[model samples]
Target: MRNVILCVMGVALLSGCSWAKNVQSSKNRVYFENLYFPARLSTNSDDKQSFTVSVDRIDQGLAPAREAGRYEATKYCVATYGNSDVAWVAGPDAPDSELRIVEGRLQFEGRCDV
Candidate 1:
């Protein structure tokens, strides 16, 4: 009985984090909703456009979250610079955004190439 209850709780937790899955075109509308989901862009002292996107809970892992972050950063850069070109700068792992869970938070980093 205890094992069954634990399994149920685990499934419930995973279901609640369905947002962590890759944002498909059918769910593009959802991405828009996450626009201001602790995501922001800032110009560094060197004039580099830095960006960061974070999600509280990640289900599938960091790859999907990183992809979503990159997408959001690109959108932001396009809106701010009339172009969507961007270059990843740094992340919790490496410059290429490796899988690393930090305090139950998933984050991605990049820089706009405006």
Candidate 2:
């Protein structure tokens, strides 16, 4: 009798999962490599304080979103999104790749030391 009760309870629980369509998804993903230079950000009258950033080399970048945990330009294209900051940066002249995200868009000025 206990086993029968457990099986019915399990079926109820499994069927209830079908009603979970309202939940937001959490699997959004992006990747970048073979970087494009000078994202060529247009000027916004400087009154807005639009900043600039750099990426030094291909292998020096550290974008964790890539499928292999590295930017693969041919397969991935790194993008910047969210609050503007000096992010995804490496050192200059040392396997360095700098990236910045601002206002939900990415900027790639150029190779930092390449």
Candidate 3:
């Protein structure tokens, strides 16, 4: 019946919303929220050319999330040093977390090739 279909759809939608809420609360939302999406960059020394990038979750997909960290690092390198060349000294992959979700944090460290 039409009513039955409508009720089922409503329940599905509500459940989806609930799952999202649970996921949000289950992870380090507060920690991630404080950081910039894709990546957060900071210099490691007073030279101002050597930098590091700390990356948070990418909701699109896990693979993209991993690559986003690299992309972000490269972007930062180019912006700061006029070249996209960069070498990551740490963390292009997501480490294990309590939630076990498809989200993660990534980090990279290196100097601009300039």
Candidate 4:
């Protein structure tokens, strides 16, 4: 009986997290809603301050991938920058082409007037 209860409880708990996964913004107010990363930025960085900004600002980098990537584009936010590969633009003129997450960086699609 105990084992059965544990299994039911486990399943319930797992599903609960999926429903509320993307509840808060990232360090830069970038709004990480429904984005999945092998290692979350919160655990992969050294600076504690950078962890607070939710807005993802790729101020300096090698170069944004002009070409699309491999991963399914995550449709959310102003823009996303991760492993730093592709940058999908989510603006009024957003194109019909689907973006790929080359490394882990993402570009939110379907813009709304801010």
Candidate 5:
């Protein structure tokens, strides 16, 4: 009797979930040319507007990594300050020689222009 009840509960739980659907929505998926690059944005403790974005796996491609970093920084500024204007200290528009890449990761620095 206990086994029968457990089996029914498990089936009920499984019915509510869809295995075919993507775990992450398209809106949240960050990718360049179907390749997903991991990016992280960190804000300064003393100044919330100042931020640094790091995108990993430069071995994949530099342009994509730069786009990923730009995307992350833009997302952060928009979310925090309700604006997209950014005063980049070191950003994507710079020439290749001016860009900073350390240990296979691209780095970007900026402050939200509110």
Candidate 6:
């Protein structure tokens, strides 16, 4: 019985590793300047048309962070609204002084236009 239990534990550990790999690969990620920036897009539960894109690791490069945020916002708009039209409230094209960064993450806000 102990040998059987050990075998089952081995199988479970191997499967867990593969499952983690699959989950990591399934994430929609963007590469910038040969590096991957972790960008995420989130929408307000009360207002689905408005969204925010946040890119982490801004210390690496501002240009890459901006591109990552823009890419994520575009992807979110396209996926949620079936179009890539976004009216930027605070976007990548804005001047450097206007960009929003908080806690090492750059954020962009926009509304998806139908």
Most accurate candidate by TM-score: 5
Give the Cα RMSD of candidate 1: 12.7
Q: Candidate 4, residues 12-79: lDDT per residue as tens digits?
A: 99988876665533333321233323212221156222221121222222122211111223222223
lDDT at 74, model 6: 83
Q: How close is candidate 1 to the true structure, as a TM-score?
A: 0.49
lDDT of 4: 0.32
TM-score for each candidate, following the candidate numbering: 0.49, 0.22, 0.48, 0.23, 0.82, 0.79
Highest lDDT against the true fold, candidate? 6
lDDT of each: 0.61, 0.34, 0.62, 0.32, 0.88, 0.90
Q: What are the per-model numbers of colliding residue pairs? A: 0, 8, 0, 14, 0, 0
Task: Show the lowest summed lDDT stretch of 10 residues, model 3.
Answer: 28-37
Q: What's the lDDT for residue 32 in model 1?
A: 26
Question: Which tens-of-lDDT digit does each residue in 1-114 have in candidate 2?
Answer: 999999999999887775453332322223245443222222235422232332333343444222122222211222322222322332112232343444533443222111
lDDT of 1 by residue, 1-114 (tens): 999999999999897677456445345443423442233344556765776656544554445556556667777889888888877655533644454456776666677787
lDDT of 6 by residue, 1-114 (tens): 999999999999999999999989967556899778899888989999998998898999999889989888888889888999889999999998999999989999999998
Model 3, range 34-66, lDDT digits (tens) per residue?
Answer: 343555678866867677766665554545545
- Which regions of candidate 1 deviate over 4 angstroms? 1-48, 91-97
Hey, what RMSD does candidate 4 come out at?
13.3
Model 6: colliding residue pairs:
none
Model 4 residue 87 CA deviation (Å) reads 22
The collision pairs in model 5 are: none
Candidate 5 global TM-score: 0.82
Model 5 agreement with the true structure over 8-53: per-residue lDDT tens digits: 9998778656442445454577888778889999999999999999
